[model samples]
Target: MAPASIPRRAALTARALAVGAVAVALAAGCVSSTESGGARLGQAQSWSSVAGGPPNSGRAHAAVSDSPGLVWSRSLGAPAIGVASSDGLGTFYQATVSERGCNLFALTADDGRKRWCLRLPTDGPRITATVDGRGSLFVPMYGGVGAVSAEGENRWFADTLGIPTTVTLLDNRHLLLISHLGIARVVNTQTGLDASSELPLAGEIPPADPGYGSPWCGSGERGCPAPGPAAVDTDSGTAYLTAWTPGAPAPELVAVRFSPGETGRLEVAWRTGLPEGRLGVPVVLSNDRGQVHVHSRDGSLHAYSTADGAPLWSTPVGYRPDTPPAVLPDGTLVSGGRTTTVWRGVDDDHSADAGPAPVVAVRPEDGRGREVWRRDDLRQLTNPAATEDGRVVVAVRSGGTDDEPGIAVHLLDGEDGGTVHEFDVPAARGPVSGLSVDDEGRIALTTAVGAVYLLG
Candidate 1:
């Protein structure tokens, strides 16, 4: 493999400065939260990390507006790679690609003004970058991870890891990076150096093939190039990742354990097989720590025990789900997709027609899934986000007639799956790139045409 290209540091005057770690205070009544993996990450305010921290529960404690209007929209003039992440301190960060190269932009959350834009030096596409509680940003590139201070200054770039597939913030001080070859490494957030040794995934990596086309890591078949993001359980010191290994016809959900302090050897705890299909979505864990949910393309949502990787139950979703499920505070699972069924009776013969997808809510009980409610009016729904007060927010693509596509953002009641409030995305496109909720109940939605909209 080729080495990562290092950039010049003419403007990085703080490269040699020893930045101290910032300490965060926790409430006295939150003892159970301290045991969970998210508490150590220290990002309680913003969508500081992807899928809202290491657990990837896709739940936010912030409250969102029922009838949110578009606060602002800015076009990147290029396509964006992933969703924009926000720092609770009033700044939003996004990454975009163009003919020139990859650029990371920091915009003011209130007004959408460019605070600073930094050009990233990488050989390939970059995954969604994550931020720490101290306002530092960690981006996964082709070969390594780059650390940028909250002030938009380059701090340090760790270039030893090879072909990063995902970069996850394990805590306030450590980042867990999975490479394209199914290898995991830990990096210190403060120093941008290797915190521990690398551990290979479930199976041995296949030999490099020069004939393969571009290795797109975003969304595709199971293990298209490498594994997707991981869901970490800090209480057990284990991370659940879905990977494709040799001799397995399909992908397997592998459990790997690592020390959160980034000072111990990474170990493989257990591995289990998933159904054969496109495995693009990451795994989600129940807040009660009873089950880990895997939404596979095989038209089913599988659950397993977190202690020993034992199969608990599997629920058929009726359609291939394209996004991860969001776990509400009451342990209810909310998932949505693009296709649905509509029955048409012709001459007493019932035929099925394709209609807009419905957002389904399921409750796990007695080792089986019980359907709670379904909302069929929403169209082209993105991955859903849960608010602290038990509401679901999703972006719907409005089919338009002309060149410009219409977009609608919906807030649903968690109990009955009813539409509480709805708003339109002004001057946007069809495909919704990403959806995230910040600590202040602010919503951020990104589009394929490089459009970013902030709603509150």
Candidate 2:
């Protein structure tokens, strides 16, 4: 484990800055939006502190809220994939499994309390979950999509033709899901109608090669390829998905629009050839003046037009950006890695004239970004969450090794990149995921092993 390289500020010159500016202008005029919003989103509330002493081992995800308390914490077996939080409910949702089968849990925001647990019928090797505006949790199970109410009740389930990959909330009442076989489905969040008709694919699959023998296959057994993640726009009924074929050299990116129809329209928005290697899912920056940011394992950030899938700009990022980039309300793009860098706009136009280079403000103008302040001393993995009182809280641990395992809460000065306050929560072991904050300013963290901590 080598020290992550620090980006040289001097290297980011006039030319590169100009490119960023151009990218923003281009995105402003060309990017388009999709998705419809119906439900209200929640926010975080309180505080707590977990001290270092015991050795608890289990991977888990956490959620918090001040009005109610600490939400629930769920375990993700040995290796967890992802965790998501709902706006006002104080309920944290995560996808996990034990020997029985894949499970989705809805937990209370005040304590490590379980609200409702929904178990899948089949053995699902991979799973992902997200919440709609209406507070329903949509999870992608093995071969179908499972809808769970915020109160922990099972709503309904929709079967899919292929292995389910990703599930995302489209708006308050609509949801979108994609499968490994390149099938994208849109369902009415309230009724669970097969809104697939409202999408563009129209039951067409990307051509497959017989000789390729399922590029994702292995050892005489079918190895399900890691399906690309899906991103949605709550304001408009638009969805974006990316997929790569076994024989194809690059990942295929697709954009689709969803509305009130049976047969939706599908179009090959944009396709870019990627280098030979495993690629992460394409994350759509909904508030990003209409641009899709694709992060590659090779440490490259590629920007595409949300409207037509046109390639806009490509730049090198710090680490293999595992988490999605955080956008502030002021249109400042705050992406965290070895270090967090703030971009003023979305495109290739890099003009110094853009007013102070888009510092990480708490709010972004495009409603896509907020300003950010960074702590160069702390190493972080996921994006930091902002408190209602304007403090940006991040989850950090010892940068290089497992010996010094801990989580830190740094209060950032929203105006300038200044540190307002710092606190540390000791951990029993190393490698913790599922970090979140409650309304009262208490910090909740889940370790790699199955212990949950309430840190203030």
Candidate 3:
């Protein structure tokens, strides 16, 4: 099928989509395993889920271009939310909100045309969906989990006890859904049924202290668990997430193991306490080692062993705490942050802030994080994706101090943090809210105002 151009609103259709012809190699940090000990057909080469697929290692193997040109752009009726997922071959899935419910759009990656849009009346706020090779999209929403086919049909819906914070693709047949109330459930992708019953992630919790360190205290709520997505290790059937009771001493990184079978179960593997701070992004796994890293809002990055959740190391990178680090193929981690400023408003009437933010690279060594390089230029970098050449690609809100006036796509050398290539987005309506790089070197970005752009 030839890709169509649909920059404006169009009628929704339940048309069948053709499977992509091109085949891509597996991404760097993504583990795509099948029951037959082979890679899955369409999903193996795709950025199938958030954070560059299951482990949420924030890594990929796309080609970086010296000058990326826009391939196409389409505007949704509402702004897209969360990280967009791509099937890598030729389709991308993004979600936008409406008054009644959520609208999930399946756009052709080649020309930014919508293949179909499925409306979900009970779909929750976040729209990060997980896609499989057989044209299945498993979405976690407010009331429950909904499965949609590639031809834009509602396959099934499984209700959950609480609102799911994130949906992670665990393996070939199962998905891991973590909810806000510390509930974890594994659902079968094919049947859309619970493989495991609702399991409380909080192993043993002390009674709640009404007004002590509890955000839900004022609202007369009993429990408030830290909300974020889980990172899965497909090989070991282990998934990691941050769990904290409102009045608990400290938050903990919890690892849960899911055994898939007729009697599938979700069991807590281990838990490790972290310093007092809100959890930042999703927990990320080290690409080469058995360590999992957590970024705390207090500007500290903590690493722990996956086997027992033992403390590995803690390092401070005093910048954008909300952004997670991207693990490269060589085991180096890259993250972006802002610089420290002393006496900000004292200099002028307006708050005089620091000029250039930093993009730092650190090597996780034995009991230490060795600083590799720091580039004090890039700012507002989305969760970065490592390319095939060990380089990093990021969407910068602003290219640099005097570089570009609008949103820019930057390809930086991972070795020295130098700009290898940069291109400004022609008509960016809003900030680059979501970025996903595919196996064929195509960079897909979504704006806050619902514009989706593809460049290569």
Candidate 4:
């Protein structure tokens, strides 16, 4: 009888894992953040990180006008799998998720020209990238979190217990990441090593122990598993994340409070359950100052006090929330669903759709959103992008089947719901990571095929 044959690569991988404990400890020398992650160059655009700064407010500081021609469109020649980010140094960071090569490109925001491209250690279709205020680019890839200097040089790679989700830079020194196995860890941004726990994700879906796995870590899945990205409050040092445990009726929103000073400490600040997963990714909406909002997958919006997990207000946003609510300077709360809805100021009991309406506005105290305006024919599929000039920007698809594609960028006056200006995009509008706006009001929209449409 022939003996069972084991894959050579599998055997080597298992053996390697066994000996890695020593290597990780020896190589875990720490480095300090060479510079402050919050330092912004004068030329830096207001949009700092992917989620637009630690409070995780998705609004651009300033929204560009509606009528504008495409500045430039550059193709990485590969699918743009993850989110895009920028720093104070005028560099836009984008990554290509390709197996032949996964290269991180640094492009000039002025003309979208490639400054430099670095080949990452492994395929990066799932790699998430972020840049600090000082221009350090960080990404989760090749089984660890990696940092690239402002000059585009590979700095260091730290081993994580599991393939991490989108990393959150709490500060120049501490980084927040969670593995698919449901373990939340704080790694020294300088060292990538978690001395306290190793919740690995390479081989086992849930690992050998169930406690190490995330709530929804699939057993039959082929690749890595982890909860989505995190919503972090930099000033308060609190991070909000969500997860689903198997057999559980609802998902869990966990707040991790970081004690950052001389000692790096992480503790669960609070935990709550939502009706469904509708809250969306990086589920918490925080200003990092006073109030935090959490949306349930069940079309419910709940606001909580940041100091202690106390309920401030609860509003039922009739339609299921597809994106986080963006707050304008004037205090208007903007969100999207089947139609564009606005809470004149987070003050009303704005409920769902009543009739066939395009835009609705009401006060949270009203308990029902009143349809302020309607464009019966237009179907908006994106969150209402708030602008400084008092306009809600939306990307409208032609509803043209995939074969006949059209994306119309629309700008509506936030005060009167009037069309400010509209531009047609030649790119296909399948779905994107939401519109990216800079301090200059330049808007960027990337289509399904990795083509970026920039408008100023």
What are the RMSDs of all candidates, in order? Answer: 8.6, 15.7, 9.4, 8.8
- Candidate 1 TM-score, true structure as reference: 0.82
Candidate 1 per-residue lDDT, tens place, 12-47, comes to 321222121111111111112212323324554667
Q: Order of all candidates by lDDT, from best down to worst?
A: 1, 3, 4, 2
Order of candidates by TM-score, top first? 1, 3, 4, 2
How does residue 250 of candidate 3 score in lDDT?
A: 71
Superior by lDDT: candidate 1 or candidate 2: 1
- Leading candidate by TM-score: 1
lDDT of 2 at 422: 58
Give the candidate number with the greatest lDDT.
1
For residue 15, model 3's alpha carbon misses the true position, in angstroms, by 25
On residues 384-405, what C-alpha lDDT tens digit does candidate 2 reach at each position? Answer: 5544443455555533344444
Better candidate number, 2 or 3, judged by lDDT: 3
TM-score of each: 0.82, 0.64, 0.80, 0.74
All models: lDDT? 0.66, 0.43, 0.64, 0.54
Query: CA lDDT of 359 in candidate 4?
Result: 38
Which consecutive 10 residues in model 3 have the weakest lDDT in total?
A: 14-23
- Each model's backbone clash number: 0, 93, 0, 24
Tally clashes: model 1. Answer: 0
Q: What TM-score number comes out for model 4?
A: 0.74
